[model samples]
Target: MATAQAAAGRTFTTDIPARLDRLPWSRWHWSIVIGLGTVWILDGLEVTVVGNIASRLSEPGSGLPISSGQVTGTAAALYVAGACVGALFWGRLTDRHGRKKLFMITLAVYLAATALTAVSFSAWWFFLFRFLTGFGIGGEYAAINSAIDELIPSSYRGRVDLVINGSFWIGAVGGSLLSIVALNTDLLPENVGWRLTFALGVVLGLVILLVRRSVPESPRWLLIRGRDREAEEIVASIEQKIEAEKGEPLPEPAGELVIRQRESTSFAEIAHTVFSAYRRRAVLGFSLFVGQAFLYNAITFGFGTILIKFYDIPAGDTGYYFAVIAAGNFVGPLLLGKLFDTVGRRVMISSTYLLSGVLLFGTAWLFSRGSLSAVTLTACWCVVLFFASAGASSAYLTVSEIFPMETRAMSIAFFYALGTAVGGISGPLVFADLTGSGVVGDTVLAFQIGAGLMCAAGLVAAFLAVKAERRSLEDIATPLSVEKAPTAEAVTE
Candidate 1:
């Protein structure tokens, strides 16, 4: 049974936050990870495959009559723009409805759009589908991140979130390998192979949908939405399963958070909460997100173009090099994820950002001098992104954790939209122009710009970062609905 005490103006207290934070890690947590986390993998796969096949889309007989620059620049920017819009649209819905509802809906949107993309006969058709695909993915970022943080125990939240976000690189590895096969003329036709690549994502999304159906809505969200009975029932069910697995009684939960339940939140309250109460966090979040978005968008969307134009590398071989780079990205989060939980968020986040930025600067210098081969250049990228990937993943983790539960999804959406607008869209456009110019110096200058932004963001993180490790979400930022108790006579009708 939930414990609640009446305070002023219908304010009531409950221990839902403490109860969730005290749960043990088990197969249940693994199920949540598999069900929700794999969205990032699908996103990575989609982006990488598109980047790898930019050249194929420009081929005369490939059904699309667009140039390589159009494919990478205009198409990529449209996708990010769609993502920005989708993040805000779906993010508001996620907060108003519920996490489970929006995540499943967004995933469905992605699957349908991606399957349709496989049948595109023109550049406009492809661009429309790509925008829809990004729209779905953008929604996933807000919904999934909020759900994962709210459900996972505080002790495990950092590493779990990082690993899940980093799983995008695992999809990258798969995409890279798949592209090598699909792009091979001897194995399959150019147009058919690229279409098949998108079809594969649909299959993966279907499987994830099945798993997602079994995951429950967040108990914390339910309680705050005035569904305390439902929240209590869900938590009781979870504790039963967990205790059954351990063959021991769970410890009693401590601490209670008092809040006046509200049916819905308004945009004005969200703006005031972010801008007035948590302005510093907003800055930190934007800095980290913009830095990573610029660096990643510049590299992922442009790497294939760089290889083909710069080093005279065959288009088919770009996937092989990309696979090597993807491996490094995956390894960074897998290896360094624990330290974010153990050593704490501020130090680890800043260090990863700074180190990756410094490494990228060195890489830019080497590339400018024409001192690197395709192979050697890829090795340099692997090193730079090993740290950058982890840092990038942490950006999502930070935004999700630092905001109030009521505004968690929207806060993530706002930052992602702003950062991607400024960085993600422009990175591809700038890099595509540089690649089209066929000047190593121009591309090197682009790399330095990405590196400098990363370093500056790292400095901001060092000073403004939230020390949120192993702390309950309520402790990190008290809910807006929380208020001090008044005498019974003072209670409003």
Candidate 2:
């Protein structure tokens, strides 16, 4: 463990990024994955539990005076809005302060908010805590994605990131099952079960926080902050650990990064790098995020309501159907994630988005015609989300990789906040209103909107997605600190 001292404003050349990238995958890597990736499960649980319990919350004896519409529409929108605000607020700090610090702080925010949410005695109280919880999760997105991508080897990065992001659905599946039990009066009282769900999220988060303490800071981040000695030590320690575990010496890292080390990147510089120098990538990131955000929010936030209103399914029983689709979502990324690395990002990303969009359009048409039952509709959702889930996960991968290292977290925050603001915030609100009308036509309209955006984004990805698989981060986009200096200090530790 080293601090950023005695290294600021220095110029140095080191192979920190390359060394980290060349090491073989080991148990050490799995530790990082477990420590950092489990937060998504908490998010998945939060979202799924809310969606599943929408009807129960709207009932007369649910402790809170919230309507189903308020739960799905107003509360959901506030949560997403908070996330957008939180991403912007915390993202800059993450880039300045380091990923480890921001992620730890953000998780604490989420835990505290969720714990308070469980004790809510009024609708406003519940809504306020939901937003606070989202604020924390939003910051987690920026910090974790940047750290995971920077730490993982280029060869394994695509699949690992996708699987980790997709693991959110595992929590969804868990929440869905938990909701069934929570909503069942025989198992637990309505007021008690729902509160317990939020409390459980806090417990899970505490476990993750304990594991996260051992997860190291990003060597790449340290290197750019002029902590070359610290960065070099971390990389060497990782190499030695991996070598000992694998019983072989790691291959020599092939390239050096010559950087003018600075303590932090300014907001103005980050904005220009993302929006000006990499303007095309900015467009691509926006398109991908909007497509996924709208599609997911519209469907997931309102799905239980769909089952209840259209099919007369009980609120407690809805979790069973949701679990099926949640499994499909997780499986899509787990199975297809490798193809992102092997077949190339453009083909896989575009194909998944386009295929899911086309499938959803068909599902919508069938639903409008009243040709499907609840069981058949859930099956259709499983098929559609199988691809959509993978496409959505890639949106994160695309944004995190295409930008320069200096702007990585902020770029993720900017596009995520922007796209989620446009799509995530509005999507749930629109879908809740549309579906709440109990008019088949209104629901169909919502479906078509999500489908069209996904299709449009796929077309954009066809032309704009980066082929970033198996490439070093520096090669993908040169760091802003990179420069040639005749008298540059070289630290080849």
Per residue, candidate 2 scores C-alpha lDDT tens digits across 1-493 of 3355556677778877878888888999999999999999999999999888888888888899998888888999999999999998898998999999999999999999999999989999999999999999999999999999999999999999999999999999999999998898898887888999999999999999999998888989988887778777888888888988999888887778678877777878888878788888888999999999999977678888888889999878999999999999999999999999999999999999999999999999999999989999999999999999999999999999888888899999999999999999989877888876789999899889999999999999999888788988777777788874222232111
lDDT of each: 0.89, 0.90
Weakest lDDT window of 10 consecutive positions for candidate 1: 484-493
lDDT of 1 by residue, 1-493 (tens): 3333322135577787788899999889999999999988988898898888888888987777778788789889988988999999999999999999999999999999999999999889988998998899999999999999999999999999999999999999999989888888789887789899999999999999999999999988887777787888888888999999999999998777777877788999999888778999999999999999999886568888888888888998899999999999999999999999999999999999999999999999999888999999999999999999999999999999988888999999999999998899888887778766788888888889899999999999999999889988877877767663221111110
TM-score of each: 0.96, 0.97
RMSD of 2: 3.1
Record all residue pairs in model 2 with backbone atoms less than 3 Å apart, i.e. clashing.
none
> For every model in order, what is the number of clashing pairs?
0, 0
Candidate 1 ranges beyond 4 A from true positions:
1-10, 484-493
Model 1, residue 2: distance off in Å is: 14
Say which candidate scores most in lDDT: 2
